[model samples]
Target: NLRALFGYMWAHPGKKLLFMGGEFGQRREWAHESSLEWHALGMDQRHEGVSRWVADLNRVLREQPALHQKDFVNDGFRWVQRGDWEQSVVSFLRLGNEAAPPILVICNFTPVPRLNYRIGVPRGGYWRELLNSDAPMYGGSGLGNYGGCEATPMPYEDFSHSLSITVPPLAALFFKPE
Candidate 1:
C-alpha cells in the first residue's frame, strides 16, 4: 500500500520509497509487467493526476536552486508539523544565504479539503507559486484558485504573521519569493 509504505519510509531515517507508477491508492494497480496501461488511464483520473503531481514534485526537488543548492537535512530542513493518524501534512523551509532567497515547501495528505490554513514562512514581500498539485495539468479536478500567487507579508511567524491559504484534497504546494 502506498500509504503504509510512505508512512513507514517517512519515519525511517535515510530510507526512500519509490512506486512503480501512481500507486498511491488512487484505485488501481500495474498490469502484466508490460508498458504502462495508457488505456487504464481512463479507469481513474486520480492516477494521472497524482502521477503528474509526483513528477512535478521531483522536478521541483531537482531544479529549485534553493532546495538543491545545499544539503537538505543540514542547512534548512525542519519538520514544522504532523498529525495524529499520520495521514498528515508536512512543511519545510529553505533559508537563504547573503545573496539567495528563502523558500517554503508545504505538503498535504488529508483526503478532504483544508481551508484557511496557516503556516510560518520566512519574513518577506511577495511570494510566488512555484508549483501546485491541484493544477489541472496534474489530473486533479482543479479546486484551487489563483493560478499565480498573491503578496504575502513579512514577519509571518511570531516574529511571523499568519500565512493563509487553502489546500485542496491530497495536494502539495511549493513557494518561492518573487
Candidate 2:
C-alpha cells in the first residue's frame, strides 16, 4: 500500500526519488529494455489512487519547508513516540526551516486501527493533517482523524504537550503545526 511507501520515504533521510514505475505499485521486475506498464494504472483504481497520492506527497515535500530543509542534519528530526514494537508505531518530527513549525509523522505498520492514539508533540497547538494514507481518496478504508488535532497540556514522550490522535491500520499520517 501507499502507506508503507510514504512511511519509508518520510521516515528516512535524504532526497526522495523512486525508480520508474515505482509510485503506482509496480509489480513486475525492473527492466531497462521495456517501458513501464503504464496501462496497468487504468486496470484498477488502486493504481490510480497510489499515483495520485505520490504526486501529492511530492507536492507537499516541495511546499513544506519543515519537511525538506536540513535533510542531513539530525537537529531537523526528533522522535515523539517509539518503543512500541508490538504495535509497530513510531512518531517523529521533522524540523525544516528554523522559524517554522516541525512536521509530525506517525506510522502504523500493523493492520490495526489505533483510535485515540496519544502521541507527544513539540507544542500545544493546532496541527493540520497534511496527508493521511488511510483516506478513501487513496483507496484506503477511510479511517483517520477528520482533518487535524489539538494537543493538550499533557506530558507525553518527553514533550509537554500531547495529542490523542487516530492512526489508521497500516497507514502513515503526516501532520503540520499551524
Candidate 3:
C-alpha cells in the first residue's frame, strides 16, 4: 500500500510515488463505480481509515528528522523483511547520522492477529513504538502491542531480532530507539 512507500519517501523525499485512482478517501471500489459515492464518508471506517493513514504518512514525512532529511539514499534507508508478502507485512530502517538512533518501520496486512512476529532490530537497545495503524483512532481492529522494544540477544546476533508484537490486518507501525 501507499503507507509503506510514503513512509519511505518520508525518509527519502526525492523518491516519487504514483497511487492509482480511488486511493484517497474515495470509496466504492470498482464494483460500485457510481461516481464515488460521496456519502461513503459517513457510511463506514474504510474511507476514514485511508484518509488517516495517508495523513499520518505525510505528517511523519514532514515532522521526523529521519524522514525530513535530504540524505536518504546513502545514509537514510534500508529494507527490513517480514514473513509473508500476501500478509502485506513489511519493514525498513531509517538510518540517522553517525551513531544516531535508527528508526524501524513495520506494516501488517493481515486481518487476523499476528502474534510473536519477529522483526529484527539493527542495534541492541530500547526501541519504542512510534506509530501504529491498529490504534483505535486509525479505524483498525485495535489488536497491537505498543510501548516496548525487543531486548533479547538470541535474535539480535543475526540482525533479525524480533519484537513480540501483535499485528492487526492492514496496519502499519513505526518504531524508534529510546
Candidate lDDT values, in order: 0.56, 0.83, 0.62
Q: Give the per-residue Cα lDDT of candidate 3 at 132.
A: 73
lDDT of 1 by residue, 67-160 (tens): 5455435664545444324547666666544466655666667777667666666554556777666677766556653743454554443435
Candidate 2 vs 3: which has more TM-score: 2
Clashing pairs in 2: none
Question: Which parts of model 1 have CA positions greater than 4 angstroms off?
Answer: 1-17, 22-44, 80-87, 95-98, 148-162
- Count of backbone collisions in candidate 2: 0
**How would you encode candidate 2's per-residue C-alpha lDDT over 1-178 as one tens digit per residue?**
5556676586556888788887887789779999998998989878877888888888888788878788889888887765778889877788876687788888888888998988988788898998998888888989888899898999987899989998999888989878
Query: Could you arrange the candidates by TM-score from highest to lowest?
Result: 2, 3, 1
- Residue 67 lDDT, candidate 3, scale 0-100: 58
Model 2: residues with Cα > 4 Å off, grouped in runs = none
State the lDDT at 127 in candidate 1: 66
lDDT of 3 at 113: 66
Give each model a TM-score: 0.66, 0.94, 0.71
Model 2 per-residue lDDT at 14: 80
Shift in Å, residue 134, candidate 2:
0.9
- RMSD in angstroms, all models? 4.9, 1.3, 4.4
Cα shift from native, residue 172, model 2 (Å): 0.6
